[model samples]
Target: MAKYSEKASKKVEQAIHTEKEGKLRTGTGKKVTSRKQAIAIGLSEARKEGAKVPQKKD
Candidate 1:
């Protein structure tokens, strides 16, 4: 896995936890049901916060 900043890792962890608890949601107000989606959501949020995350692979 690529390296992620502490903040980014924390955000992802929080997102995963929320997902496992069935509390995560999407922009369309739909429930999050997949772990991969949750991780993507976390990375997206990390990008928003300017965390030290790598660029998306092509």
Candidate 2:
């Protein structure tokens, strides 16, 4: 199992809350309507922040 850092987890939580409150928007100015997409965005942000997130394994 891969482990995500505290910061990454926090970002994911924030994204979830933002999505639930209809406060999340994409870069193209479109509203985010999916929880999974919000989570992906959060993880991407966490990666940009240098969090210890592992790459997806397939």
Winner by lDDT: 1
* RMSD (CA, angstroms), candidate 2: 1.7
Residue pairs whose backbone atoms clash in candidate 1? none
Cα-based RMSD of the predictions, in order?
1.2, 1.7
The segments of candidate 1 whose C-alpha lies over 4 angstroms from its true place after superposition are: none
Cα lDDT tens digits, model 2, 1-58, are 7899999999999999998999898889889999998998899899999999998556
Please, what are the lDDT tens digits per residue for candidate 1 over residues 1-58? Answer: 7889999999999999999999999989899999999999999999999999999888
TM-score of each: 0.89, 0.89
Q: Return the lDDT, model 1, position 23.
A: 98
Backbone clashes, candidate 2: 0
In order, the Cα lDDT scores of the candidates are 0.95, 0.92
Cα deviation at 38, candidate 1, in Å, is: 0.6
Per-residue error (Å), model 2, residue 17: 0.3
